[model samples]
Target: MGHVTFFGVVTFVFRHSAGCTGNAISSPHRCILVPSFEIKGKNSMPKMYRTKLAAMVKNFPRYASANQPPNGEIRSYIESAGHTCELRDAGEFQSPADVVNLVSEHPKFEAALAIHLFKAGRLLMDIEIPFGVIFGGTDINEDVKVEQKRVVMEQVLLKARFAVAFTDKLKEEAELFLVSQSSKIYVQPQGIQTDVTEKFCWTEFLRSSGVRTEHVDELRVFLLVCGLRRVKDPLYLVEVFSKWHCENLLNVLVIIGPKIDPVLTAEVETVVKRTAGVFLAQERCQQELHAAMKRCFAVVNSSVSEGMSAAILEAMDLGVPVLARNIPGNAAVVQHEVTGLLYSSPQEFVRQSQRLLSDHELRERVVRNGKLYVEEHHGVKQERETYQRLVDTLH
Candidate 1:
């Protein structure tokens, strides 16, 4: 794939046969000149700069932390393109001094990128090195609600040379809130891949959860995957889901993810203790989580805010039908009644779950369409190429 590159931008010449031998790319729009490693320019041979990047990213623990996985994957693309990347946890940057300390520590780093706009994107402010911003969910969806934070976010945007949003909807949100950044912001949907443990025992997993009723073979499991936090809204569907489970012995609801917040974890723990068929499973690795998704009836998302959800995309790629909260982020990925079901409230979720249970043809159609959507949009090759293009800008 050939990418359009700017005249001064040191980028990959993707068009091999287009006489892009040297790194200098010629096009009306900017071109991604470097398909293979080569360089050229009209004035003179382009100067080769440092390949090291200081990538400050958010990382959550235990299981399926959204930020860390994509951070790792995209950097892998950057590294494969011959860039040395240092992935620092963005959470550690409490103030501007922390960022200055990081830059001082890595004297050879040519550039830096902050993964989440609100969390670490502010670090880009007052830095001399060229930098970019990657918008995470809460940064735009939640943080922009505050006046002080919005002012700081605007500063971060003014300083950023480039930015990446996980979805077009997210890009729109950023542009709407901050204004005049649409050109620099690129819409890159996440690449999808899932490796399930073939030997994983669904029965064993169920038994361990301790929320399954008898005749487990006949039960339908719905997975709600997210790090336990207020934004994730882990408790959103609990009351209705518990009621639905009690009304039918063949249904169960399992909440699984790392406990990101101790306070929220306690609240969920208390609810699951008394709620029948509502189990709280410990967060599993990506492989194990995929195995659960494969064996489950459907996956659910009830987030108050989202950037691009890896779990939702992973579930679709795995051929698991999804029931997501009707939000811009989820809606951008999931087409209601086509790719997956979308419910506005808990009652709607119960009704929709029942539809997924009773309507055999609908299930098959949704599953098929969801899988096709993933294949078309989110693939390993697509992401590798996108990141390769993105990293080239840092040059």
Candidate 2:
């Protein structure tokens, strides 16, 4: 066994007779770590039979990072159960047969998990492996609305050993489309860990991201964290945010996430170039991003849909106020005026954001309640236990 550290992250590597066993620790960047374990049986030291676990994650640079929460958290929980998991990029394969062919070359896997129902799950349908699908934000909120995507997702759900939804609202929405497998759908909110490092420097982040130094002293930052994609609607508030910025010159909306969609990324770049008080910061490690969120007046979410946002939960855990779009996925967690503020349109967002920034009492009340909500509902221990039980069913 040996270890390697990269990008300030440490990973353990262990060699096995069959090959190396590992799982990625998401964050600044992916760091694969292999755990040491021994398979057990009754009397004698039984021949070790490692429980091969395969995970297919969303194909995006951010998803590949150690700070993304979902994949890394799941991998950690699976490993804690004494299983060996290898996470692969689902986008690398062409079809279900391709996935099967790749897995066939490895040790017979006991179970497999795919990140998104409509994306990765559909590709794993015909694979000769017992697998489960986890509904991403788009799977329930966007993909299910498209007839073709919905049909394929329902088929995948039917073939799936089980399906996981991050929230009960999401489970209910999915059931409306996949009624037959409603019994197998489980609700497990994404576990969150806000581990912000003290090394984070807000001034340096602003300087590197092209934020104007002249306005730094009076800047009131609202961090909008989302990958640049159509579904995420990263630029939904760009025009209005810029207009408001011109009016006050105090508020700035800093968008941060990976470039998942090139066309959208280009559009965002164009908008940021012209829009005053609106900046696009490169994606930071989870800890650094959360630390930045803490520095901001509030965290914003402008997604068209969500499957329980780990970002929102992380902001709440960090005691940062949340301002999210009024979608079911966001609503399920943000109880308007309670845990966080929810808005339906750009104008509503502006109005609510102003209130959050001006009303000290409102901000304090909501931030306090949001932290409590996460502690009471999204406890990491509870999420770990629930996933462990789900993995047990695979046996």
Candidate 3:
């Protein structure tokens, strides 16, 4: 793919025999040409530009902590492109010399890709590697606001051969910091395994979470699946539900995800202890989570910030309508009043939740639309093709 800058708008020229063209018209932008291409073969994989590749991650467990939709998906795609992909835990490296030594041990690796630029825990300035930097949510969204973290991130962005973000929003946000190097930013959506089936045992979830099956039938449950971190705002629903529970409503709110932050975990624990309707459980396996979402009335996302929410997407895929924070990331997935409702305040959320619970027709409509939206937009096939295009350009 070749990119051309015309009057400040960046247009991509895709290589194909039967070329297609389109435009992205935004405010301060018009007549921006986007060329498309006809794929030549059915099994077309990107030509590998580098023979060997290394992936540097922060904490192996933390990097793989929350469901790594894009990272895991792209790793498979990269490997399929005929490059040797090796994983490195930068958490083991204490200093710049340690990073250099780790890279030195893998001399055969021609290029490296840092998954989380800042969290990789290596002084990249002193490490010599032909590497590209992939910015996670923290690097561009949170770290960039801090002067020191921004400086380090800026160096990584400036020195990297290319950069990757999970969404176009993140790509545009990346331009604010690394405006001159905008050409290197690629838009790749995370991929999910689409072979979802409703054949899982709900009893397994009950046993794993220590909640008896009797309690399941006693409450109308709403599940919020996300890591217990401050950014996720897991307690937002807890506070609202606590108030609602006093009304003698037969409803329960289950918050399930890995406890990432100890402080936030304690806060969630306190809320769970005090709140009658709220239940906190350890993160369940993916299949179990899917089954849980299938059984629930609706899914909720209360993230203060997000790139693209995999939890919300998975819920939509399972034909569950979502009630999400009225923010960019959630809005990108949930079309307000169509697929789901968005709220900025606790009052608005409670109102929406009550409405969704009471109105079966509205709930069915949203669920139908959300299912269609996910199938069309966030399907695994679409993501795989997008990655193929991105990797094709690497050569």
Candidate 4:
């Protein structure tokens, strides 16, 4: 209800046009627009909940943003507010048998919060503790399609002390897969923080990314950030992007992120070697990545599905306009023309990318709006406080 300026106007027009309700947005710096449900007591100060927690994360050495989730943030929020937290990496939601065997020997904690439903939640089904579950990108979108996983996920939900969703759209998509647990599902958008490295070397980055030194400033770099995985559909736009680069040598497309999947990584490497003007950049630290993003013309998201993209949010925070594949999760963050451009097809993606290159007014508007959206809705303080409040349910 504040800042009724151009940002508000842009948000209002889009929400109405898309028939979005008051509660339809999210912030990863996602801008989910949902308020945190606090746990204030009557009269006296509210009691703080403090205890050790076994927070589960996608702990893969080749993963870029595994720690970029509610579990990672909540660990600090809980500890800083007077509690201890331990992170357990159960990468890829494989079998929970290994984790279950380990927790059986560890010291007990007060409560727990896990990122993926089946991975962490199911891991603790027999651990005997109150816990909350945060949905992941593939959890609600792809994995739940199978009947067995769907049933187990539902069971996880039925037993969880609480569940967190990055956006309302994800919550709805979840409802279609299982019986509605609207009462316990919290639409708390993930919070993102960006920090760039000091004196980052663009030339070094280019060299590492397989770009020629002579063509540093001559090329317009459009970065695609994603961990190499099947669900991410890293190759969805590669063929088209390669074609675009062939037509215009100045148009460079770089895929930068961790090699999450060995098979997918080999496939991507082969394509990049054979492709024109498309390179695979080395994975940089979070700070370096942010710095590289600043130099790029724009950021891109070609994920088949996303709960919310920390990369896109980081790009917007760094004043880089995003060109995202049009999917429900991406759409929740990007308001098409208002915040960023969305493309349903690779052809549309090229068209939008060109607009960002040639249409100054359009690009400027989106960049400004994207930054405003991130600031207004997503903040470290906001997410921390919200998680603290949600975790209080275990008390």
How far residue 393's Cα lies from its native spot in candidate 4, in Å, is 2.0
Model 2 residue-pair collision total? 6
lDDT of 4 by residue, 1-395 (tens): 00000000000000011222233222000111110110001111133333345555553221254223633345556544444454545542245554344333323344556666765556656545566777875778877988898888898899887788888988998888877898899887778778888979998898888898587887799988777777678788888988998889889888887776788899999999998888999887777888999999988888887888888888888999999988888899999999999999999999999998899999999999999999987887778877767655654
Off by over 4 Å in 4: 1-48, 59-63, 66-71, 92-101, 104-106
Segments of candidate 1 deviating more than 4 angstroms: 1-50, 61-63, 66-69
Q: Report the alpha-carbon TM-score of model 2 versus the true structure.
A: 0.86
Q: Model 3 TM-score? A: 0.79
Local accuracy by lDDT, each model: 0.68, 0.67, 0.58, 0.66
Instruction: Mark the regions of model 2 whose C-alpha exceeds 4 Å error after superposition.
Output: 1-50, 59-69, 214-217
Model 1 CA lDDT for position 172:
84
Q: Across residues 73-185, which tens digit of lDDT does each residue of candidate 2 receive?
A: 66666665555556566545566686556555534454566667776777666656566667766777777788998999888788877777788877888888765677899
Superposition TM-score, candidate 1 onto the true structure = 0.85
50-83: candidate 3 lDDT, tens digit per residue:
2344454432322213323344454454554444
Top candidate, metric lDDT: 1
Error of 3 at 324 (Å): 1.0
The clash number for model 3 is 0
- The superposed Cα distance between candidate 2 and the true structure at residue 203, in angstroms, equals 0.7
